[model samples]
Target: MGADLYRDGVARLEAGDGREATRLLEAALREAPGDVKVMHALSRALDAAGERERSVQLLELVHAKAPSEPEPACELAMALLERTEDTRAAEVLAPVLAAQPDHPGANLCMAMALAKTDPERAKAHLKPASRSADADQRAQAAALERVLSGQSPG
Candidate 1:
């Protein structure tokens, strides 16, 4: 039952129905407490639903449960960055960055966290993301580069 709910919730989330996804994911979590995959999916649904604080909490839980993995840390850092908590985001990312310096998502997020306070540092972080084969990541990196370079991105 929990797995079914989780699958449907993920489908909804991928289809851009975050509110429905959240409801189903919450039910999944209740049926399978402490399930990291469900928790991560719920965090993503919550984030899409604009429940950033809840997303952060769930991401934190997942990260705590699996510190060796970088996904939760990256998600948590991005969530913190969305909340304008750059320092906290940086703190969350520090270890991940140290362990996987070239991880594209981590680099992109670190760039975002440092963009305002240290444009040069952000530029360094953005380099790898810009070179990534993922078009979205490259676009984001390019946009950030424009912003840092005092030019408008369009």
Candidate 2:
């Protein structure tokens, strides 16, 4: 039952129906409070619903509960970046980078965080990000690579 709710919540989130997604995910969380995936989904739904602070808070909870889990760390960094808290985003990615230097999401988020202040380092990070399965990440990595190479982003 909880898994069904989680799946429906994710589908609703992907469809951009964040309110319904949030409702479904909250129900899923009630059924399995320790489920990190449900928490992550709820956090994403909150973010999509414009509850940025709430989203960050939930991600933080997941991070605190599972410090060794990379998904929560990556999601938290992405949420921070979305809030324009680049420094905080970078800080959040630090441990993830230390634990998994080649973590694609961490590298991608770090690349965006450092792009303005450290183009060379950002380019290096983008190497892994460009290879990510997420098309948006790939596009951003490719565009940043072009920018760092002194060519117009194509």
37 in model 1: Cα distance from truth in Å? 1.4
Who wins the lDDT comparison? 1
Candidate 1 residue lDDT tens string, 71-148: 888888887877899988887888888888898888898899999898999999999888888899999999999999
Cα RMSD for candidates in order: 2.3, 2.4
Which portions of model 2 show Cα errors greater than 4 Å?
Answer: 68-71
Evaluate all candidate structures by whole-model CA lDDT and list the values in order: 0.90, 0.87
Task: Superpose all Cα atoms of candidate 1 onto the true structure and report the RMSD in Å to 1 decimal.
Answer: 2.3
Q: Point out where model 1 deviates above 4 Å.
A: 152-154
Tens-digit per-residue lDDT, 1-154, candidate 2: 9999999999999999999999999999999997888998999999899898898899998887776467778788777777788888787888878888887777988998887788888889998898889899889888888988899998
